[model samples]
Target: MQLGLSNKDQKKVLTAFYSLGEVCGTIWDNIV
Candidate 1:
């Protein structure tokens, strides 16, 4: 549902709603 979209969209939703370790590093990079 999310990974298909742009990295921005994926980060926006995941950072706010989810906390799966699989994506933590990716999201952290997105934020910083």
Candidate 2:
């Protein structure tokens, strides 16, 4: 499945998750 987000958008969302918690790394897809 393709994420409709641009690379920069993807990075920003992931960065937000990373800022929230360490588990975000493992469950990035499910959380968002």
- 1-32 in candidate 1: lDDT tens per residue? 53678889877877776556657878888999
Task: Tell me, by lDDT, which candidate is best.
Answer: 2
Compared with the true structure, the alpha-carbon lDDT of candidate 1 equals 0.75
Candidate 2: tens digits of C-alpha lDDT, residues 1-32: 45899989999998988777866655887877
What does candidate 1 score on TM? 0.35
Q: Point out where model 1 deviates above 4 Å.
A: 1-3, 18-32
Worst 10 residues of 2 by lDDT: 22-31
Where model 2 places Cα greater than 4 Å from the true spot, the runs are 22-32
